[model samples]
Structure formats: structure tokens, C-alpha cells
Target: MMLLRYLSQIGKYFLMWKEIFNKQTKWPVMKNLIYKEIDDLIIGSLGIVAFISFFVGGVVSIQTALNLNNPLIPKYLIGFATRQSVILEFAPTFISIIMAGKMGSFITSSIGTMRVTEQIDALEVMGVNSLNYLVFPKIIALLLYPFLIGISMFLGILGGWMAAVYGGFTSSIEFINGAQMEFNPFHITYAFIKTLIFAMLLATIPSFHGYYMKGGALEVGKASTVSFVWTSVTIILINYIITHMLLGS
Candidate 1:
């Protein structure tokens, strides 16, 4: 029964996707919507992203430094480990999960409210492709998600350096050298790939909950909560799958 229910949902979701891009929106309207969404979703999220990333990076560095008590372990390893953690996993995947909370709730509640208010029905009555109008702009805006993640990576590394130097864990030169050593451009590529996938999921999953929700004001809150949980789960699962496929399990 559960499997069947999920299959039905999958089919319905695909149907939604099918309608999301059938007719192009007017260029002027779309342009304005896209810009607004970019400001709302991307630029609006910058402060929290920077705050968490910097502190988390510092914590990672501190923990790495403390764990390497052995004399044989080089001090520069603190920076190196922090770099790997921040770039490969923390900045991209974990931060995305955080966004799932903020952005997902907004998407679900807004859409769910529209659903409850019969706004969507009115759109359909008017022959408007509401999903395309509402959700596509969000998806388009999040195409810049990789850019956000890139900023996270830089701030994370900077935070690590600050913590390491201030905490007297390592010399600045040593940390810089270690971070530079054996730097692989492919890591950035992998991170961006994950960011892009997560971006799509971000735009759609919450919209799904809100769009399909069948209830009143109270239910919109419920839908938002459900959307956040499901979005987080989907992201974690996809992260694991992508990691296994790309880097081998």
C-alpha cells in the first residue's frame, strides 16, 4: 500500500513537471519574477549562510587540531582536513539542508495558501499555467545556487584559518601551504554538481507539498513542516547516492 501510494505521487509529480514548461511566459513578466525570486531566495539567504559556514569551519578546524595529538601528525593537517570537509560536504550538502528548512517552508506555505484560497483554481480558470508562473521562476533563480555555495567554501576556509591562528594551533604559513598542496579542481566541480541537483530539488519539493495540499489555513503549516522533512530526506539520500556513484562506495 505504501509503495503504491508513493508510485502514484511520483506519477503525479511527473505530470506537474510536464506542465511546468509547456508555454513560455512573457519575457517581461518572467524577467521581473526571476529577479524578485533571486533577491528573495538567493541574496536574502546570504547572511545566515555566511554566519553558519564561518563558525562551523572554525569548529571543524579546532576539532581536527585537537584530535591530532601525535607528534608524527603535521600541524598543517588541520587546514587540509577543514578544506576537504568544508568544500566537499559541509558547504554544499549540509548548507543545502539548512536551506531546505528556510526556503522549503516559504515555498510550501505560500503555495499551500494559494491552494487553500482557490488562487490556483482561478489561474486555471483564466487559462494561465500557474505552476510555470509560480515555480519556474524559483527554479531559474536557484540556478545561481552554485554561486552561493562557492561563497560558502571561501568563508569556511577563512573561518578555519582564523580559528587555527587565533587558537594557536598552527602558523599561518603552514596552514596556507597545506591548503594549497594537492588542491584538486575536480572537488569544486563535484561540489557544484551536487549544488545544482539540490537547487532543482529545492525549487520543486516544497512547491509540491504546497501545490497538492488539500486543507485550510491550519493545513498550510502542516504542509510546510512536511515539505521541510521530505526535502531534507531527499537531499541526504541524493547526496549519498551521488557520492557513491561519483567517488565509489
Candidate 2:
């Protein structure tokens, strides 16, 4: 029974995906909508993302420093580990999971509210492609999601440097050298690829839950919670798969 329910929901989600591009909204309207979404979803999220990235990066560096009890171990490893952690996983995967809660709930509640108020029905009656109007802009806006991950990467490394140097774990020069040492450009490519994929999931999955949810105001909140759980789970699953395919031997 549970399996059937899950499969049915998956089918519905794909159907919504198809409908998003059908009878597309006009370019001018869509352009404005895209701008609105970019403001609401992307620009609005910058502060929290920056704060979390900086603090977490510092934590990563401090933890690495503390774990090295052996005097023989190089202090530079602190920066190396922090750089690898932030660029490879913390910025992309961890921050995405955070967004699954912040942005995901916002999308779900906003759309679910529209559904409850008959706004979506009204749109349909007016021959408007509500899915395209609502969901497509979000998808387009999130194309810049990689930009957030880029900021996160920079701030995270910066935080690590500050924490390590101020905490006396390592000198600034040594830590910078470690951060630069053996840095593979591909790691960044991999992170942004994951960011792009996660961005798609972030935009679509919440919209799915909200668009299809039943009942009234209460159900909107319920759908938001379920959407968050599912989005986070899906992100984690995809992260594992991407990492395995890209890095696993």
C-alpha cells in the first residue's frame, strides 16, 4: 500500500513537470515573474546562507584542529580539510538541505494557499497556465542557485582561515598554502553540478506537494512539512549517488 502510494505520487509529480512547459506563459509576463521569484527566493536567502556558511566553516576548521593531537601532524592539514569539506560537500550538499526547509516551506505554503483560495482554479478558468506561471519562474530563478553555492564556498573557506589563524591552530600563510595545495578544479565543477541538480529538486518537489495537496489551511502546513522531508531526503540520496559516480573508485 505504501509502495503504491509512493509510486502514484511520483507519477503525479512527473505529470506536473510536463504541464509546466505546456501552453507556456508569455515571455514578458514570465520575465517579470522570474524577477519576482529571484527576489523572493534567491536574493532573500542570501543573509542566512552567508551566516551559516561562515560559522560552519569555522566549526569545521576548529574541529579539524582539535582532532589533531599528534604534534607530528602538520597544522596546514586544518585548512586543507576545511577547504575540501566546504568545497566538496558543506557548501553544496549541506546548504541545499538547509534550503529544503527554508525555501521549500515557502514555496509549498504559497502555492498551497493559492490552491485553497481557488486562485489556481481561477487561473485555470481564465485559460492561464498556472503551473508555468508559478513553477517555471521558480525553476528559472533557481538557475542562479549555483551563485549561492559559490558565495558559500568563498565564505566557508574564509571562515576557516579566520578560525584557524585566530584560534592559533595554524599561521595564516601555512593555512593559505594548505588551502591552495593540491586543489583540483574538478572538485568545484562537481560541487556546482550537484548544486544545479539540487536546485531543480528544490524548485519542483515543493511545488508538487503544494499543488496537489488536499484540504484547507491546515493541509497547506502539512504539505509544507512533508515537502521539506521529501526534499531533504531526495537531496541526500542524489548527493550520495553523484558522489559515488564522480569520486568513488
Candidate 3:
């Protein structure tokens, strides 16, 4: 029933990936597309990611401080909590959900439009593997997605520090010490692992939606919305599964 439909979709998605690499588009052409996508997908999204992430981190710190009403709680706990939340969850998972809306919609609508306009058909008729030409470049471009997440992690902590100090929740010394205290590089590794997984999802899921979409402009819009929802859900579910697998006790 519904379960089978989902399972079938999953199978088809993997099969598309297999075909995507079967014989890639020419290096020169793919290289240009890859560079363009890097600009569009990675460089283009930096501003929004930085702005939202900074504020969110600050809010997390302020909330943590406010909740610790008891005098017994050390002020540095604000920094500690913010670090754990941002590095482990906020930057990697929540930010990815946001991108699933922004980038996923773009991918879906762009491809869906091409589908509607018969551009994909023309490519197929010319013996070109449209999926590979269209999607592999996006996948290659998103490999740099970890770098974006890295920036988010740094800015998030910096914003938390600023908010906590300016808001009188803690002194600069206390916050700095707390942020560096008990630091585990493994947490960063975990975050980057999740970022890489998310990058693949970002490229593929939306491409799948757009590539398989039918009909005209109206359907493209519908596909974009549907792609965003499914992409977000898939990301959250995978975040849980990967976290449990990697960090579970």
C-alpha cells in the first residue's frame, strides 16, 4: 500500500543515481555546470545561513540563561549549552531543513520547467544521459557544503558569546572558558558527517522530484512544494538515524 509506494520510490531513486554515473557528461561541460552550481548553491546561500544561524545561536544562549534562574547554576553553562546545541543539531540539522526549502524548491522548479519545456526530452533523444548531466554537477558542487556548515558553527558560537556577554548573562571570560571547556573534536566530525549526508540529499531528492514531474507550469509549482516537504522530512529522519548510529550509547 502506502509503504510499498515509498519503498518503490526509494528503489527508483537509487537506480537513478546508478544511471547518473554510468557515463557522465563530458568533462568540460560538466565542469562548467559544477562551477555554476557551486556559485548558485553554495556561495549564493551563505548570507542567509550566516544571518539566521547567528541569531538562532544568540537566542539559544539567551533562552538557556533565562531558564537557569537558580543562583547555583554557573553562568558559563550558557556557553556550554549553546555549543552543544549549535554544533550537534542546529547548524547541521535545522539549517539543512531551511536549505531543503530554499534550494530544494529551486532545484525542483528549474528541472520541472525543463521537463515541461521538452528540454530533457531533447537531451535524451541526442543520446545524452540527462540525469547525469543535470544532477551529477549539483552533487559535485554540494561536496563543499561542509565548509558552509563550518562557517555556521563558528558564527553561531561567536554570536552566542556576544549575546550572553551583552545581555549580562555572563562575563566574557566565563563564556570563553565554557566554550573551550571539554571540547571534543569528535562532535565536529559528527556535524561534518551529517553535513555531507545532507548535501547529497540536497542535490538528489529535489532532482528526483523535478526530473520525474509531469505536466506544465502549474505542476512544476506543485512539485517544488512537494519536493521541499519530502526533502525536509527525509533530512530530519536521517538526522535521527545517523545520530543514533554514530553517537548512541
Choose the strongest candidate by TM-score.
2
- Tell me the spans in candidate 1 whose CA falls farther than 4 Å from its real position: none
Ranking according to TM-score, highest score first:
2, 3, 1
Q: Which candidate is the best by lDDT?
A: 2
The Cα error of candidate 3 at residue 103, in Å, is 0.8
- Report the C-alpha displacement of residue 88, candidate 1, in angstroms: 0.5
Candidate 2 residue lDDT tens string, 1-249? 999999999999999999999999999999999999999999999999999999999999999999998999998899899999999999999999999999999999999999999999999999999999899999999999999999999999999999999999899998999899999999999999999999999999999999999899999999999999999999999999999999895
Model 2: ten consecutive residues of lowest lDDT: 240-249
Please provide, for model 1 over 1-249, each residue's C-alpha lDDT reduced to its tens digit, 9 standing for 90 to 100.
Answer: 999998998798889888889886788999999999999999999999999999999999999999999989999898899999999999999999999999899889989999999999998888888999889999999999999999999999999999999999999998888788788998888899999999999999999999999979999999999899989999999999999888774
Give the Å error, residue 62, model 1.
Answer: 0.4
Q: What is the per-residue lDDT of model 3 for residues 4-92, given as tens digits with 9 covering 90 to 100? A: 99999999999999999977788999899999999999999999999998999999999999999999989888889999999999999
Q: Which structure is stronger by TM-score: 1 or 2?
A: 2
